[model samples]
Target chain A: MYSKELLKGTIEIIILKLLVENGSMYGYEITQQVKNLTKGKIVISEGALYPTLHKLEAIGVLSTEIIHIGRRQRKYYHVSEVGKDISALKMQELSSFLHSLNQILDFKLSS
Target chain B: MYSKELLKGTIEIIILKLLVENGSMYGYEITQQVKNLTKGKIVISEGALYPTLHKLEAIGVLSTEIIHIGRRQRKYYHVSEVGKDISALKMQELSSFLHSLNQILDFKLSS
Candidate 1:
């Protein structure tokens, strides 16, 4: 399981990347996808997930569609073309961070 | 300059990493370091920088000290030991992101 404190930054990237891979999905579906992919290791609470999703959508990185599914209206989020481009850069930025992290971790482990 | 929309997630990592490199610094210093390091390409505004700093400190990743400098007191933030470890992980996480980003960008460019 990821640390809640650390997870705030990670969640946004996961949301964007998931939308890039999946055409569109609603909040519950996104929540489930994360849970299932992590083998239930990461359980996303509604409080943390919804606000981040809402903020991302508000910022135009994601576009939402309201669809009637069964007895209720569900909002599905899809990545905008701009979101895809940003995702690409975000992915690169993360890789850079990982390299630095590994170096620091290894150095610490050795010392 | 980076996109404000894309910057929210990035700023946290930048703040942590800067603290890791430089022992302790205040809000203005953090902003200046970012600007100077980027050769003024990236300017961190008061709105974005202070909130993130406070949030990180609140989360225990950063510990702040109020030093009397000049005519007033300035709060200087240093990474907690935990923050350093997290920073290391964050660096590695970013590296992983960059690799994925490069792959996506290259594929897009070629296609």
Candidate 2:
């Protein structure tokens, strides 16, 4: 698992980016995708993941549909139109922040 | 204000980075620092910031000291030893993510 301290901040980004890439997926699927992508290095716990999904949906960044598969009702999440634009902007802002950080870390590398 | 979708993911990083830069600060000070740094473009509501802080401290990534200043007791947060190392790693991971995103975004720009 990744560091809790670090992962706390970026879990939403990971969820959003995953939805952007995958179209739509259920909660378990989302958690599984993160785990598979990270090779089990990052596990998004159900406790943490569910609340985040609920929060994102509450904010209108994500819209969900409930589907009944057998006995289980699964809620699938997808990005809203606004969520897509917000994702792009967030990617840009994160890029800028990373650039600044690289400058700090790579100061000696370039010289 | 920054996009809610985007800021949601990076708020923890922002808080951690601020603590790393400034040593230690109280909740209000941390909120003010974020607001000032973003030119009031990113406001961390007490509703949000307090929980994030409490969660971080709960996980042992942060340690808090309660200090009485005049009329109120303020809890100040600082990075733990583990938090500092985790911060460094998260910075690296985020940097790597930004690099990949730039490559995708800039591919069209470069062409």
User: What does TM-score give for chain A of every model?
Assistant: 0.87, 0.87
Per residue, candidate 1 scores C-alpha lDDT tens digits across A1-111 of 443444545566777777888889888998887777656655668887899889878888889989996989999899888888888787666544433333322222111
lDDT of each: 0.69, 0.70
In model 2 chain B, the worst 10-residue window by lDDT is: B102-111
The ten-residue window of minimal lDDT in model 1 chain B covers B102-111
Task: List the candidate 2 regions with Cα displacement exceeding 4 Å.
Answer: A1-111, B107-111
Could you give candidate 2's per-residue lDDT for residues A1-111 as a string of tens digits? 333544544567778888888899998998887666655667778888889899989989999999998998989899999999987776666545434333333321111
State the displacement of the C-alpha of residue A86, model 2, in Å, after optimal TM-score superposition: 11
Give the CA lDDT, 0 to 100, for residue B27 in model 2: 91
All candidates: TM-score: 0.51, 0.53
- Tens digits of per-residue lDDT for model 2 on B1-111? 443544544567677888887788899998886666555666788888899899889998899999998998988889999999987777666545443333333322111
